[model samples]
Target: METTLTLKDVTITYDKKPALEQVSLSFPKNRITAVIGPSGCGKTTLLRAMNRMLEEEPGAAVEGQILLNGDDVQKLPPEELRRRVGLVFQTPAPFPFSIYKNMTFALRYYGVQNKERLDAVVREKLTLAGLYEEVKDRLDKSALKLSGGQQQRLCI
Candidate 1:
């Protein structure tokens, strides 16, 4: 199988402490790869670094390269990289916006300005996530009103 994501000598650290050191792996296309370990073993750090979410932390720093389909993630714009690799945090933090706006926030941030296109992408992503059909009629409703499971899929 072809490689879809590759990490070469990836290291992550918080403040002056080491989290991951010299970890390298290639994830094959069309397959699920799980990073399993005990707490504080850098599993979350590895995923965050792959999607460039490590930059969100004040003291978090990354080393080495994360390649998505042969393109270096560090070279790609952060917004673009995030769009390509969506992260669902362990916690769900719903924004104070309508379901439509909540779903399209990232699309708009990535410069998707066309209303029709935005609607289409939001519906498509939500449909793929198995959330749109449940909330389709209430697209204009506040997303905070959704049930826990619904909100989870929307966040995803």
Candidate 2:
């Protein structure tokens, strides 16, 4: 099998606390991979390190390398890298804005501004998530008002 992602002695830490240590792994292309472990076992930390999402946390640190298609992730543009290697956590954390705003705000930073296009993309994504029909009439309602499952899907 061909490897799609490669991790070489990757370690992550937060504020001097070790999250992951000296881990090496490879994920093959076209295969669904799962990283399963007990709580506090660094599963989330490993996923975050894959795309540099760890950088978002205060005092987070990463050692060694994560290579995507043989290119060091540090060499990739942060924005482009995130877009290409996205992560949606197990928990749902919606913004205080309306569902429509929450969805579009994610794309705005990527230059999606036109109302028509934004609406189309929102509808497309929400529909694919099987959440459009339930929330279609309430797109303008606060995203925080959604149910846990709904919020998780919306946040996706």
How close is every model to the real structure, measured as TM-score? 0.82, 0.88
| Model 2: per-residue Cα lDDT over 1-156, one tens digit each | 799899999889899888888999999999989999999899988998888888888999999999999999999999888888988788889999999999999779778889999999999999999999999999999999999999999977
- Against the true structure, candidate 2 reaches a TM-score of 0.88
Off by over 4 Å in 1: 107-120
Candidate 2: where are CA atoms >4 Å away? 15-17
| RMSD in order of candidates | 2.4, 1.9
lDDT of each: 0.88, 0.91
Q: 26 in model 2: Cα distance from truth in Å? A: 1.4
Please give the lDDT score at residue 129 for candidate 2. Answer: 90
